[model samples]
Target: MTPEGKALSNIVILGFGFMLMFTAFQTCGNIEQTVIKSLNNFTASGYTSMSIIYGVFSASNLVAPSVVAVVGPQLSMFFSGLLYSAYIAMFIQPRVWSFYTASVLVGFGAAVLWTAQGNVLAINSTDTTIGRNSGIFWALLQFSLFFGNLYIYLAWQGHDHISEKDRQTVFISLTVISLIGCFLFFLIRKPDPSEPTPSETSEAPLHTESTDSASVSGPPRRSLCTQALDAFVKACKLSVTKEMMLLCLPIMYTGLELTFYSGVYGTCIGAMTRFGHNAKGLIGISGILIGVGEILGGGVFGILNNNRLGRNPVVLLGLLIHYLAFYLIFLNIAPDAPQAPEEGTDLQAYMTPNVGVALFCSFLLGLGDSCFNTQLLSIIGFLYKEDSAPAFAVFKFIQSIMAAIAFSYSNVLQLPWQLLLLVVTGFMGTLSFFMAEWGVVAKRRDSDYDSI
Candidate 1:
């Protein structure tokens, strides 16, 4: 392939790999329906078994990054793909143990894919372009998942049609996609030599200082591990300045709100179904709105940040909108429950006030929640140049961890508790206010440093 073709191919392959892995990881979004169906075909223990399966997957994210750091990105992707394939293959058995085991493997593999993709993109793109590239990558992956879920939902149609055999088929197809991704990874050329190696780029400033004659007369040799360790230590020791803290607040708030929305959305769906509402279309519409929101938020934020509008005000405004959306969800829509039947009847009822509230809440949540991460990522790109990948990775990891916990708690808990979880999450938005303020101050410090 020509250089351009090679680059394009790399992006395509990597992007597809990311999409497949993400689909596998996020298939949990369908778990409520899947578990409900599994109970009818299998023994009563199926629900608990499914929970165990999901919980294992959630726990895996905590360790996936550490694994990726030790294993090279290519190996990480390969190993992850292999594990995903194995997991899907095992789904044919439909045993509880098989489900749990498959979930763990899929989770581990997905973490590897996630970390590797970010590293690859960072290596390939410049700072100015990285946010846009990342946004596009994220958006595409999400779009793939949206369609994947739709396909599954349409195929299954009603809960009765989702047999173990059918579930196996679904996973088998996913495995094939993963295998294709793994094969494509081999075709991906190594990072361009013109681009800095991960180690060199991550520790460029230190390496430059060590080599400079004014700083050190001789070639100051240091082990890569030592340099990496020093870089990490420096990153950690760099106390969260008032500016840094302020900058992080908006992101953190959005992160918290995101977790809440994810948790509440599922519960709201169940609630709507219980209240005799057709929520399927509403759910799909919410997904599209979220995609649109992300595109708008990331694209506009990137352009504005690149031009003149500073990151803080834009992010702050997004946060405020997010906060309002959450308030609307909690106060206006989410509190209503299905009214008790006036007369015992065999016939099913139609839409309830609760369902209407849920649909509206979902739309608003999608609008507000979509922009949080995109805006935060763009801001991070604006803040640290060399450290962007690692920093963003760490931030994403934190969000994943928190989101996993929120999901787990939502799954286990009952109604008011779930709502309470969301309410608490809304309060977390307060943190974003400080993060925005911090970013404003940090820009000044950055300017002063540049002047020096």
Candidate 2:
């Protein structure tokens, strides 16, 4: 096959593998708070576990570049997948010790997995194709939300609460599915360094210095600790740049919104008793709609990009849609919905909860999220193709920290206050993103003038 064809094939394989693993994990994650609460009636256990995962994920991003540099992206992904599998398997028994311990491990795994993922995607793409490739991968990865939720809806149909036998069976099946996905990492062929990058002609390459020796023959033996320290320093330097500093606000917003839409909103849907006994199952339906919205957003923004369009407009559009979503969520759902289950008479929402409106809001949340992520991926890929690993690590680091903060407060804040925070952050993030994009454009224009 041609090199171009081979590159596309690798991208597909990577996307599919993630779809399988996350389909299992995301589905489990959507209900983690509710499930844990059901088991022990402690509201904080599930949120606490999620907080730990993102907290560790935030710290681990510092080392992810070093790990990916030494192991290569392919191997890094495989090992990270193992960590994901172990975490998912912990749901079978759901012990505090085992669950929290697994959470910490998976947090580290998630950092490596995402940083390596960015490296592989960056290497496979070119100046113009990065947007399209990011779109394809995101669209494919989000399929997990649809398939996993569909399974939950079916397996959990007619039952208000999950039974022990059924819960065990569900988790076991998901574990096997995740393992199958991990095996696909072995099939990926690393990108050849000879491939062209946007940085080759216009600027100095940003590839991590230590990994320069990685070649077809094999990487040279070096002290693992030394390589790690060097990579960490590189990441820190990149993080302080004006461009990176500007982008941090938007990056952090993505993490906060991710937790809101994926975990908090779904839990709110599950806690509503006004819809009757089967209300909890609405979480599954909401997941399906979210997947659909995300796919549509990815297709429009990621896959269908042209020179006429740009990242800033897409981000602004996301901000508007999120405002609409927050408005609906604020009015339609009660402040206390996420706190505990609410009966028909006990409910005190601004407007009575309607399944249709709630589901529509879910769709909007997913669509807005897609807009932010695909654009961020495209922006980072275009601007830092040479330093892809550490650049992505910085993005993930900020994002995970914000996510940890959001999860930490998920149990404490009411729905209205949470919505307020998201609204304000969305506005600030979009403005900051616009500033960053403008700076990039201005810098490029100056470079072109210099060449003249």
Instruction: Please report, in order, the local distance difference test score of every candidate based on alpha carbons.
Output: 0.50, 0.83
RMSD to the hidden true structure, all candidates: 7.3, 3.0
Query: How would you encode candidate 2's per-residue C-alpha lDDT over 1-452 as one tens digit per residue?
Result: 66667778878999999999998889888878767766754333777888999999999999998888677677788889999899889889878888889999999999999998888888878877888889999998888899888887777665677778878888898899899999887776645446555533221122332234354444345565665677788899999988899999999899999999889898898787776676667888889989988988988889645455578889999999999999999988878877674232346578888889999999999999999999899889888887888899999999999999999999789989999999888899999999998987788789989999
**Over 4 Å off, model 1:** 1-13, 40-70, 84-92, 158-161, 195-200, 203-264, 274-305, 320-351, 354-360, 382-384, 412-452
Clashes of 2: 2
**Candidate 2 segments whose C-alpha is farther than 4 A from its true place:** 40-44, 192-195, 198-226, 341-345, 448-452
What residue pairs are clashing in model 2? 206-386, 207-386
Please provide the root mean square deviation of candidate 1 (C-alpha atoms, Å): 7.3
Write down the TM-score for model 2.
0.93
TM-scores for candidates 1 onward, in order: 0.71, 0.93
Best by lDDT: 2
